[model samples]
Target: MSALAPDPRFVSQAPGPGQRSPFLRRLAHASEPWLYSAPALILIVAVMLVPLVLGISYAFRDVRLLNPFSGGYVGLQHFHELARDKAFWGALKNTLWWTGASVFLQFFLGLFLALLLDKPFYGRGIAQALCFLPWAVPSFLSGLNWAWLFNPVVGPLPHWMVSLGLMSQPENILSDPTLAMWGPIIANVWWGIPFFAITLLAALQSIPRDLYEAAAIDGAGGVQRFFSITLPFLAPTIAITVLLRTVWISNFADLIVVMTSGGPANRTQIVASYIFTQAFKKLDFGYASAVALVLLVLLLAYSMLIVLLRQSLLKKG
Candidate 1:
């Protein structure tokens, strides 16, 4: 038999001066994009990669500003301490509550607002603005207002609620252990609604009016039109929004810090604030970093799960 043809590298397979291999040709034909996308790549590396490295560094070394040598290479001691921490578990649970409730409530309420506001009506613009008002307000500043509103007295809101019998005797919403956590959830939900509404409203507007009109002609009612045309089209946006907000709320420690300090007795502690308490309040940097690392792991796991679930559902659909 004739000897096997020489490999392409051994015998140059030059088609022409301008011609190239299929793979190389495709790559050459398409812009390499290194220079064009370099700025974004650098920015992502600088912002995300640097901070992540720092976070991991802090996790390993028991360093504090007071003493750089406060650092000790006590391998997995931090993780062990965090594993034994009651506060960490409590905080993790609260994080779940905040993220789960906030995302759910925000999506539905915002979708409702987007739908109603998308429709023709007098003063619709004003109504939309009002609905979005909470989002316009700064989060910490809004927390203060919510904090005051839930105060037992001195605030009009609780007093008015008592008079309206919506709550009994100027109820201190956050005074109770059970109610404190929900206050932040409620505040976050109110603040978050506009974001979802605005995102979804833009998507909703892009939808053709003809679809609705055609559905109506087919005798589908408002509810039917919504479920069929609106929801299927809007589902992807809703999923994206929920996933983003879930991740966002999962790390939220500010509102809890400002409003309750994780308290009425550590009742409202979340992993973020718990980490804060461990690091600064308790002076356990190594242990705190362990908790932080665990928190990061949980979020990473959840995010991966969500992506996989989304892909699976997309495939099935």
Candidate 2:
């Protein structure tokens, strides 16, 4: 019999190149991610980037509120003013204290809480929820609540201090310039601790239980395991969280604004609160923008330094 002609449909054929145009395929592949991210990119540009650029521009121009002819090019005049302003220097110092103390206290307490929560325990879910509830409250509401708590008339804190012989009488610490800054710092720490706890708790959970088991089996102590394994794994998370929190706390003025309004004598006036006072109270948008720009530059420098330090430490390790 003659060889059966190969069925046309079933005949094996060499794979042809992709029928779609190569250029079209390449373009589509390259554009896929951008297409998915376009909405977010556009929103950021419109809301954040645009306002940032405008604010920067205002730094170089006179743009006072309620002034029809105020948008004049001023060229570093605001910076010159800021340099000579005593209040600005005071606020800068206050910002450092506020951010430093708040970040440190929050990080330590949060880490301790995270460690406690990492172990299995009854009612763990409820405990975690209760501890994290502070973060769920609005920042402004937290500020107001803390402010109320500091009131000698209606709050128990002052009375408790007096009863403990820590104070001569029940007094509002918020009115005492020397101690006023502490009030806001305390509030900030209380509100921020949950944030670090939640983040560190998640990081802690991600650690391999096997590592701890192995370390224990090798005769490692609890302290040793934490220092060697837990700490190393948590270093990155701690660094990032601390850096971001520092920046945020420096810019945070709500609690100060609501509690003390910059003080019995501007003792609690951080740069952020000062900026608010300028733009809203004094209606000097240009000056406020200039101050904001200076703060932004300082924060940027701080962030860069932190990143460099982290990279150097990582290299050393």
User: Candidate 2 at 39: error in angstroms?
Assistant: 2.0
lDDT for position 28 in model 1: 57
lDDT of 2 by residue, 91-199 (tens): 9999999999999999999999999999999999999999999998888888889888989989999999999998999999999889989999999899999999999
- Stretches of candidate 1 above 4 Å error? 1-33, 36-40, 164-168, 280-283, 305-317
- Against the reference, the lDDT scores of all candidates come to 0.81, 0.90
Q: Please give the lDDT score for candidate 1.
A: 0.81
Give the distance in Å from residue 255's predicted Cα in candidate 1 to where it truly belongs.
1.4
Candidate 2 residue spans exceeding 4 A from truth: 1-20, 305-317
Write model 1 residue lDDT over 1-317, tens digit each, in one string: 11535446634654454544544654555657776888999999999999787777778777665665687676776777767878777878888888888888988898888988998899988888888999889888878888988887666777887889888777777878887888888888888899999999998998899999999999999889989999998887788778877888888777877888888878888888888877777776667777788888878987997888778877876
**Could you give me the TM-score of model 2 versus the true structure?**
0.88
Q: Considering summed lDDT, which 10 consecutive residues are worst modelled in model 1? A: 1-10
* Candidate 1: pairs in clash: none
